[model samples]
Target: MDDLDLRLIKLTQDGIELVPEPFKKIARELNISEEEVINRINTLIEHGIVRRFGASIGHRALGILFNAMCVWNVPDHRVEEVGAIMAGFDEVSHCYERLRSPDWEYNLYAMVHARTREECERIAHEISLATGISDYTILFSEKEFKKTGVRI
Candidate 1:
């Protein structure tokens, strides 16, 4: 990565401008062509310097008040199949498979967001019904301590 690439990263680390041509805007700022800006970003991604380049929505700002961490005690053999189903739900923003111990047998987790706790529960129920995995718990988030992407 060159200086221009560094500048491009710094410019877009927070977010790209909400313009009709965000890349063109960045190109102007970087004194490079729009294609170069896009190519640099693509190279960064291909090289795994940027694992993801996507939107980050603010659920609270959108009136999605309840965020629940739903944990499921999925059978060891079906963890992948069950996790895919859980991740497919629209309400679930994040799904993960975690190592469990004797103290905590829940191996699968998903973060579900909704306007209310009841909605969260309903979504959880829908997930349970879809996956046929009812041995689970939903822990609502009481507070948000941090919500930001990694800084370069």
Candidate 2:
């Protein structure tokens, strides 16, 4: 990545504009062509400098008010298998395995989003049934304080 590419990364760290021609707008700012802008981004993605280029949806704005993290106390031997099963759910936005602590026995974590708490619980139940790991807990969020794009 050259200076222009670095500048592009800096400009896009937050997110691209919600415009009909966001690349065009970026091109104007950088004094480059729109196609160049897209090519630079594509190059970054192809080289794995940028893992993903996508939108960060506001689920609450879309009537998905209930959000919770479902933590499962999955066995060490089954962490990857169980995590993948939970991650496969459409209701789950993100799921992964983490290091467990002495006080906290849960290792698998999944972020579940729904319109209501009952729906969230329903998804959790389905995950439990699918994984056959019943030792789990669901902690609902009272509010969404922060939702922002990642910095490069």
Candidate 3:
């Protein structure tokens, strides 16, 4: 709600360092007390500016070599049910419902990961079967251009 709160949100958008007393380090750099930084973050969340704060681990470091964006043509009536089922899977890291496209009419989107390409395909097939949606597509990432957090 104040300038300090805005600065805290901006700095935190870049992701926090995974170190002991990370907030203390941030406070030192901002010339504020650690408690102030923590309180401000809480306030920001209460204001709906911060959806959630957490760490994102690199999938490669966990031996997850395969990742793909799986899109599904879920019926409008069943979108929520299908999305919840897809998101509940451990392989799915992210899931969302978007507007249907011309080339691809899928509204349900999910990110899947596995150890190999075949594994990824199998998971996609399973999702299709589970959702009872035969029409789907998998767009695998050839290379990662950027994965860093955004700064607002």
Candidate 4:
């Protein structure tokens, strides 16, 4: 990546506009054409320099102040299948499998976002109905101690 690419990454690593022509605004700032910005970003993605290009919505800003981490005790044989089902839900933003233990019977974790605790429970019910895996727990968000984005 060149200096301009680095500058672009620094400027937009956090976020970009939600408008239709966000790249045009970025190009204006960089003193380059919108096409150049798009081309550079595409090249970066091709090389895996830019791992992802997307929008991040702030739950607080959207009045979605509540969230939950729904942990599921998925069967070993059904881990992948169940995880895929969980990930397919629109409410779920992050989902993955993890090691389980005697004390911790849960093997799958899916983070669900909602505006209220009740909404979180509702989404969890939908997930359960979708996956047929009722063995789970939903831990509601109390406070956000730390949150960060990717950096180079």
**What CA root-mean-square deviation does each model show from the true structure?**
2.9, 2.0, 2.3, 3.7
lDDT string, candidate 2, 44-77, tens digits? 9999999878876778789999989999999899
lDDT (10s digit) by residue, model 4, range 72-138: 9998999989999889999898999999988999999999988888999999999999889999999
lDDT, candidate 1, equals 0.92
115 in model 3: Cα distance from truth in Å? 1.5
Which candidate gets the maximum lDDT versus the true structure?
Answer: 1
- Tens digits of per-residue lDDT, candidate 1, 8-96, equal 99999999988888899889988889999999999999989888788877889999999999999999999989999988998898999
Candidate 3: misplaced stretches above 4 Å?
15-21, 28-31
Over 23-105, each residue of candidate 3 has an lDDT whose tens digit, in order, gives 98789888999998998888888888877777767889999988899988888999889998898889998899998778767
Query: Which residue pairs clash in candidate 3?
Result: none
TM-score of each: 0.79, 0.87, 0.83, 0.74
- Reference-based lDDT, each prediction: 0.92, 0.90, 0.86, 0.90
Tell me the spans in candidate 4 whose CA falls farther than 4 Å from its real position.
1-8, 15-38, 48-51
Higher-scoring candidate on TM-score, 1 or 2: 2
Better of 2 and 3 by TM-score: 2
lDDT of 3 at 27: 96
